[model samples]
Target: MKTKKLLTLFLLISGLSFYFSQEVVIKDDKVLLDGKQILKAEKINVLQYSFYSMKDDEEILMFRQMDNETPKYMDDDYYVLNFLTEKTKVESTDFTKILNFMNSRKAMEKLIKWLLKERVINNDGELNPERVQTFKEKYDENITDRTFR
Candidate 1:
């Protein structure tokens, strides 16, 4: 009947609206979340392998760099490392390769503690501090020099 068709049409429209409301998109190299620009690079640093985001309203950090020699721009390396390790499974070992290994180890330990406090992973995650330490001991037995040469 006409009533049944109208009801079906209304439901279909509502469902479609809801489904498209949360969609995110990338346009012109900018990341748009819910139709708002969330991430747009303002400057690209090729040597550092980093960039600054255009949006400042978001809770996420905007500045990121990979260079080990230059002074750190952001002071939240501990927090950033924790988030990066949790989200990407990548550690900042390239810095250790260039700088002091001890410094990197200390930073990694702090990152582990931060990850634990944030509860980003379950107890059994392999990146747990204790597990990482044990693994490092077993595999990295020859890395005794902690100071940069």
Candidate 2:
């Protein structure tokens, strides 16, 4: 009975994943959803495959052991983003509140990256030979593929 129940649960989760992923296509600077151009990207950036936090005003390239940040006195109008795997296209809106987040699979990919990095790189800010291998395994360009529909 235990094995049967586990199989049922695993199958259910697998089916759900397939159902949720729809096709998103890129055309020019815009992303098409359900064959509709719903979002467009102005800029795209990919760094040395480091985990990112929109909360962190600075982009932390952990492998490089450095941070990429705008000049301290720059205006707040600028925005940055990380994307779902294999895409760099994100969307922004000019609304009443802050517009500082991306609209792609930003949450999923970022979390996965952080978790993978954490595994090889132990706590206390240590980077072992294994950690360097992991970082290279997940490297992406400063502006690879952007525009997730």
Task: State each model's CA lDDT, in order.
Answer: 0.36, 0.36
**Candidate 2: Cα lDDT at 140:** 33
Residue 51 lDDT in candidate 1:
17
List candidate 1 segments past 4 Å from native. 1-13, 16-20, 41-149
Cα distance off (Å), candidate 2, residue 148? 36
Model 1 over residues 22-134: C-alpha lDDT tens digits?
33343454444456554442223322212123534222212233333335643322111212232322333323322324443333333333333444322322234454344
What are the clash counts of all predictions, listed in order? 0, 5
lDDT of 1 at 87: 31
For model 2, name the residue pairs that clash.
46-142, 88-145, 88-146, 89-146, 89-147
TM-score result, candidate 1:
0.25
Quick one: RMSD of model 2? 16.7
* Model 2 agreement with the true structure over 106-134: per-residue lDDT tens digits: 43233333433445323322234454444
